[model samples]
Structure formats: structure tokens, C-alpha cells
Target: MESARDKRTGEIVDAEQLWIINPVDPMGYECRGCSAQATPCSYRPENKVRPYFSAKDGHNAGCDVEGEVALVKRARKQRVTIREGFPGSFPNRLVLRDTRPVSSPDGSPTAPSSDGGRRTGSNGSSERCRNRHWAAQTIRPICRTFINYPFDRDLPLVVPGVTADTYQHVFRSLKSDQVIQYPEPRLFYAPISWKASIADDDRLEIQLSYGEWKERKLTRPYRVRMDWTDWSAAKRNYVSREIETARSEYMTAKKRGDKEKGWLFFIGRQDESDSTLFHVDDHRLVCCVVNEVIYP
Candidate 1:
């Protein structure tokens, strides 16, 4: 599905927006088509199937982004193929792959032979995502520096498993006359453990343990706050939840007589502040990951 409204929050979420917060609580969302409850069917980062939503019941007759429409669109694009291209100026880049359907284990296409290539099986959701799609993948690159514009050329330092497309899509979505450049710093997943603290100024800072931060080559132990307006309600809520969860885990571990430093992950953007301070911003361009997860 292209987009759906959140049943709980009444927010409109699209496929591009869903990628950041994969494995979300399925019950919180519903299909925009029929207003039926929706379940997110996202592929693993390594999988080719583009993440999508499926109606818990079935698609309605008037669904715009599903069924035949989706099939026709997928069939027309057929495949995304990227060839070796010139390397650009920006050394580091985030790589995003075009979403494709997962192939069958038998190495055959999964599009149903019945119904004249029309998708089948449970509202045809599975069929739509899987059938008649080519296996070829394309890698689109986005610059990692804190520049106002995305790099027109590709680079060697590509961040693996980070599905970020060229900034063109994001820029188009923002529809802004000017945008800040976003810096691509290190990205850490859940296993690293993240800790967050709120200062009196309402600045949200996240950090690792002092020793760990030093070992990781972090010049500063803490991340400064981005402008509050840069955050989406969804992103703010998720950050709050993650912070609370981290605190809860810390207390639980302490009660168990285990001493451990909580894990800390970076949020918002990392911009060039004063030479002494590590600067970060919360604008959509700077915090691309958070923007997708939080915004519609």
C-alpha cells in the first residue's frame, strides 16, 4: 500500500515513511483503502521484498495503492539495475536499494499462473509484493556530509544495510526552498545499548559510557539537542519510549546485582557546531532516519 492512516494517532503514513520503523506494532495502523486494520509486512534489511502493508481482512474495491494498480506499476518498472558508475567527491554515502519482491525458494517467479497473472491469495497482498518482479537491485546513494545539497556523484564509502535513497525523494517530499546539509555519522543498532538524558534547557542528549565513547573515537561523550521543531510527534514519542525503556532496563539490571553502562545511540543530526562542541540538528534533512519514522 502507498499510504495508510494510523488508527490510533490519525496520521497518514506512506511506504517511504514506514521503512525507518520496521516491525512496528501492526495493530496501531489500518489500511487507508477500506479502513480495515492493517498489518505491516516488511522484509528484512537483506531481503528484496519492499516493505508494505496488508489488510488484516481484505482489500476493499476502491483501494487505490493495492491489487491491480500496484501490479501494473510493478510490472512497468520491472527491475532496478545499477551499473558501476563514476565515484563522486563525497567519500561516504548512505545506500538505498529499490524494493523488489522476494523470489521463491525454487528460483522461479512467484506470480500466480492462474487468473491471467492477477495476484491471488488473501487479498492478493502477498502476490502483489512477490509476483513477476525481477531480482536485479539498484543502489542509490546519498551524501553523508552536512551540505545543503545531496552529492550528484557516487562515492566509495557506502553505508551497508542502510536503505536511504537519493535526497531527491526526501527533498521533493519536504518541498522546501532551502534545506540544511545532513551529516552521516556512525549508526548503531539495538545491541549497543543507548542512554539518553534531558537537560534543564530541554536539550536531549544521548551518549555512551565515557570509556566506550573514547574508544569509539567520539570527540564528545554527549550529543547536543536539535531544534524542537525538527522533531515529529512520532519521532519524539519513539525517542521518549526508547529512553524510558533504557532506564527501565538499567534499573532492572541494577536490581539483579548486575552493573552495566546503558547503551547510547545517536539521534537527530550531527552538524558542524563550534570546534569544541559536536553539533547536531533535528531538521528533516539532518535527521533523515528519524524524519521517516516520525513523519507521515
Candidate 2:
């Protein structure tokens, strides 16, 4: 599972955030749907795969997680329009909290609430719950949804500091042909180039696949320069590791004949002087996502 409920803190945490914990509690996680015991996997730095949670034994009868996955898959196969609304639940807003309460060791184990895995409308009806939207703690889930539901890009979204309302308007793709000035900030995404990137103490610059090419060689590609000047060593490493892991996964899939591409997503502003460059500071606002084709 991509997310699980923390028994100690009564909070739903994304699996990617496990690295921030000094020592993860083995018995502190439970399924967000069935409240079954969950085990964290591939969370260590040595693990190349992305971190996720799995049931310790098996999920209980009528686990919503499986149903939710099925619903998403079914929705992906359909042609969705903005007037009809999204067929499944999705995160509509990005909520970036400055600080979170620390989990107490002596705290009582908290079970997942009735509405933990799903959201209900004001009427509290099952039909209304189908199109519910939740707030996301990180941009990773938002990026996943963006890639999964390409047909529903017109769905409503709320990203702080961004003026755009729909997913299609909020996410801007960097053009490879020419550099253009962006007056408004946006959530930018670009395909990662296989070329070598620049990493230094002050910042890390990553080359995008889209750029000016000369005889099949990338001449002037747009780049994202992450300023880790105020970030700790661990934080910097986390960001770098995520990008590497995504690239590795994409390559592995490609070798197996899967058409996949590693894409970088970040909420940043384009440089005024250099239109080919973007500036990102916070690690939380940036993530690497591998786009995969979902077969019905």
C-alpha cells in the first residue's frame, strides 16, 4: 500500500515519509482500509525499490484497499469528462504543514476510524462518497494521480501559492524547442535526460530530456537546480536517492519492454534571467515519478 495509518500518532502517513523516522516502529502501522497489521518494506537506503506497506499476514474480509485499487483501474479505462466528475476519490488540495507532532512511545495505539480510508459528503451517503476529495500531505501522491488519470486532467485542484484551479492548468510542461518566460509559478514537470547531472555542496542541477538537440545530441536542455543550502545532509541525500531510485526503476521497466519514463515534478518558479532554468528549494515540494502504462 502507498499509505498506512500510524497507530502511535493516529495519522495517515505516506510510505515515502518513513525515511524521516529515526527508528520505525515495527508494530505501529495498520492498513488504512481494514486496520490490519501492516509491515513496511524496502524502506532502507540500500533498497532500490520504492517503500511501501503490505499486510503482515492478509487483509480482513471486505478490505477497501483492493476495492479502491480496482475502482481506480476501472476509472482509468473510462473516458472521463469534467462535467461528470472523477469516478474515484482523489486528493484535491496540497496541505504542507510546517511541523507535525512527534509520536509518543507510551501513547495508546489508535485504530483507523470509519472515515479513515474514505471520505463522506455532508449527507453521509455512499453515493456522495464516490467523488470525495481529500487533502494530501505531500506532493508525491498528487504526482501519482496526475500520471494515472491523464484523461481527468481537468479535475479541480488546489495547490497553495498557485493560482490555477484545475490539474491541467496547474501542471506545466517544459518545452524542449525554446526557452519561454513564465510570469506565474506552477507545478512543472519534465522528462529526465540520461546525461550526467551536476551535484555540489550548494545545489544540484538535473538535465531534462527536452531541449535543443544537434545531430541527436542534446545541446541546450532545460535544467532544475535544487538549492539545498539550508537543508541538512540527510535531507539532501533523501532527495538525491529518490531521483536515482525512480531512474533505476524506469530503466528496469524499459529493459523488460515496458514503455516507461522518469519524470521530475516540482513546484518552483522559472528563473527570470534564465528561462531554461528553474529554482527549487524545499525537498517536500519535489519528487520523481515514473510513468507507466496501465493495461486493463
Go through the candidates in order and give each one's C-alpha lDDT. 0.38, 0.75
Tell me the lDDT of model 2 at 289. Answer: 86
Per-residue lDDT of model 1, residues 103-156, tens digit only = 456532354221123235685453322222111111111211212122322223
Regions more than 4 Å wrong, model 2: 80-87, 102-132, 293-296
Worst 10 residues of 1 by lDDT: 132-141
Query: For all the candidates, what are their Cα RMSDs to the real structure?
Result: 15.8, 4.8
What shift in Å separates residue 8 of candidate 1 from its native position after superposition? 14
- Encode model 2's per-residue lDDT on 1-296: one tens digit a residue: 88776766545677887776668887878876666899988888887678899896988786666466776675577645456655555678887767654544665324322224334557875321222466677788788878777767778889999999988888887776766787888888888876666889999888888767788877778899999999988878878888888878777777888778888989887888887888898888888888763432
